[model samples]
Target: MRQNLNYSYPQIFWVEGRPNLGTSCPSAPPIAPFPPPVPDRRRKPKNHTERRSVGLLVTSLLILLALTGVGLSMFRIFHLEKELAELRESASTERIPPALEKLIGQKEQSMKKEARKAAHLTGNPSQRDLPLEWEPTSGHAFTSGIQYCDHGLVINETGFYFVYSNVLFRGSVCSNQVLTHVVYKKNPTLPGSHVLMEDKGINYCMSQKTWARKSYLGALFKLRKMDSLHVNVSKIALVNFEESKTFFGLFKL
Candidate 1:
């Protein structure tokens, strides 16, 4: 019998029932093994990568804290420097004792008084037959008081005065003359001059080719204002006018 040959049946290419997509569809690209479910490293991380990221974040935070701490320390250092400067300035302006200042002033006044009322003079030979005129401008010689009519040192203020005089009698020939040194005070109220200090050299430098004798007179006396002092020697020719040899001075006490 002749059957209908146009009947349709299902097409079978694989006998194992599962289609091999690589071999069955040769026109398509060979199917990969789904790429083993590849993961996005940017979105998802491994265990060690997560730990590294966490550690990096912790290290960044620590660095930021350290910088902030350094800033605060610098600020505190500047503030303390300013405070220390102020303390030093205040200490420099501290007050001194009042008694110490008074003592300094008193010492200055005493020095001024000594310069004002004192007189130191060296011997000066004069042609006039009066008391010896003194050389005030000689070495180590000064006169704070003025010359009383070119005679002697004039007292400016009344006080206790220590008067002193030295006379050196030197001669080439030894005659043993009486060397007399006399310091006298002449006041305008008094009629004549009064002797304040006196000394005599007798039998001094007796036996020698060159002989020298010295007479010194020194005394402290209560003097008055405007009183003039004068030094007199017995023989002006025998007196040596050297600074150390003959000198006269007076100071108020």
Candidate 2:
């Protein structure tokens, strides 16, 4: 019965008024196994790059510390140097010692004394004829034989005079053997032997005792004008102890 096909029925490709999308769609082609979820792997880090970064950091720190230490030391050194310079400058401007000033004064006085003496001696025409004797001090007593010395001054009762010659030792002449202090020795004939002038030779009244050789016989003449004793006498008595001979030489007067 072609009767009344008017009854509404769902279309094959449409559901009600909307078209059907695909309820099963052939199972989506099996999804290719989802490519195993792409393995979820992570990329490896650059080991050399990381190591180099750490090393660079450490080296930079070390250099920075070293620089800091050096800078500090340099600063301290500069500070100390400035202080030392200031101290030296201050010292340079400071006053000298009083003792030093006094020493300078004494030296000037000595110069004046010498100048006066030289002027007197130089102008005196008869100075050559005047006898020069060593000025003796009041308290000091000359020991045995007269000795001339090149060094040392003796101040005694008379005045200040330099010794003519050093004392001569027996057998040989030695500086160590030079007579210095003087003392007296007792003898039956001479009564007592006297020693005087520590380093210079001794003089005694005893004529029996042998006299030592005089090294400064020449100096005796120069001293002649110093006193009134023997200004005209230019000859000095020299005794050769070894040969037991007595001789005389021209005086330096």
The best candidate in terms of TM-score: 1
Tens digit of lDDT per residue, candidate 1, span 55-154?
Answer: 9999999999999999999999999999888878867986445897799889989888777778788877654465887788768888764444566888
Shift of residue 253 alpha carbon in model 2, Å: 34
| Per-prediction TM-score to the true structure, in the order listed | 0.57, 0.28
Best by lDDT: 1
Q: How would you encode candidate 2's per-residue C-alpha lDDT over 66-100 as one tens digit per residue?
A: 99999999999999999888878868987546898
lDDT at 240 for candidate 2? 23
Model 1 TM-score (2 dp): 0.57
RMSD to truth, every model: 14.6, 17.0
Minimal lDDT window, size 10, model 1: 19-28
